[model samples]
Target: MQLPTTDIAIQTDRLTRSFGSNVAVRELNLTVRSGEIFGLLGPNGAGKTTTIKMLTTMLPPSSGAATVAGHSILCDSIGVRKRIGYVSQMISADGALTGFENLLLFARIYNVPRRKRTQRIDETLAFMGLTEARDKLVCTYSGGMIRRLEIALSMLHRPEVLFLDEPTIGLDPAARLQVWKRLKELLETFGTTILLTTHDMEEAEELCDRIAIMKEGVIAAEGSAEELKQRAGTESMNQVFIHFAGEFSDSKPNFRDINRARRTAKRLG
Candidate 1:
């Protein structure tokens, strides 16, 4: 059966994925309203990335179904890909290429018409605050600059929805704030719906219109930041996560793991 379209930008019904006896995501169902910033928060291996991979069509679901931008994931994977832009946790830019060159290349890859390609690239660079550095090689740019350039590349095709996996994961405080600022601007300027996955509690609370907290391959809690805090009887998102996912123990990796992952990704890149 075809999934019915509604006002929602994305929806899933009993979406699941498993590898042998191990289920990465179990009977997942979610609705993300159009033009809203929705955050998916979870600990490592809680199925956040697995869910994103399925929605983005990088991996097919083991069972169940989903729709993105009114296109069924099962029947129209290409349609979903055309309407959404994705920025993975790993950076997706060529360090050897100048920022402008990178955007121009993606423009061609996305099949932007030759007449409109230059205008689109220039607009994206200015929107991302990289016009001044447009001629500089990406290798010399700061962590935040690279992130912004990646986002710019994703926006080249003018996707209706943006899927961001840890968009601000490894930057310093100032750079993180700058990324947030640009994201908000994008939201306002383009009215783009965003599905974000993040480990930072404060970032989720600050940016998301609604959030779903996942644990053991299921949603443990869902609501606005204030509603979640009220339900947990706490004043902070950190405490709310603890209340829902249980306390973080020494057995689990901490923020240091995120740092290590960033370093490893950089080295691999």
Candidate 2:
């Protein structure tokens, strides 16, 4: 089935992934409308990261199919990659470099035209509110500042879709809100469709236009945050999350999961 490019930025048809016997994602059929913030809400190990990897072309799906920006993830991976920008949970900016230098590096890596590189970098910095700190070393930046710079790097290429995995993971509330503000402005200014994963209920409620709640590798509920709250008979997204995902079963994250999360937080903290 084909969708009009103007209407949909992402679509998946029973997309699945597995590592040996562990099915990280199972038969995920999802659609993200153009220029909207679509969130996948779940706990750790809920397959959100795996789904993102497949959509961003970093991990090939074990089965099923998907498309981004009107390009097939299976048949036209390069095309899918070209139209999207991704910010992973791990930090990507070089701390050794100044904010401006980091953007310049990404501009080159993304193959932005030399003539447009400086202009693109400047525009992205201003949009992300990083222009004043352009010459500051990334190591000297706050967690929020580094995250914004990472976001700016992703946008330097002017991608149509941006994928975020655990965006704002280790930031303080004020910083998280700041990032959310910039993301809202990004939609208004560039009309870039955003797909993000978060375990933070407040973050989802604050930033997402629509959300899919995942449990054991599948969507248990999906709708606007308000719609979900209504469905779950509550006003809080935290309650909505618990109503759908928490009551299911028991299995705490293992030591590996705990350690991985700590490392990510340490880096971004």
- Model 2 TM-score is 0.95
Q: How many Å off is the CA of 28 in candidate 2?
A: 0.8
lDDT of 2 by residue, 1-269 (tens): 65576799999999999889888899999999998999998877788888999999889999999989999999999898889999988889999999999999888888999999888888889999998999999999999998999899888888999999888988989889989998999899899999999888889988999999888889989999999989999998888999988855443455675676678788777
User: Can you tell me which runs of candidate 1 are displaced by over 4 Å?
Assistant: 1-6, 249-260, 264-269
Q: Give TM per candidate.
A: 0.93, 0.95
Model 2 alpha-carbon miss at residue 140, Å: 0.5
The candidate scoring highest on TM-score is 2
Query: Candidate 2 clashing pairs?
Result: none
lDDT of 1 by residue, 178-197 (tens): 88998888889998889999
Clashing pairs in 1: none
lDDT of 2: 0.89
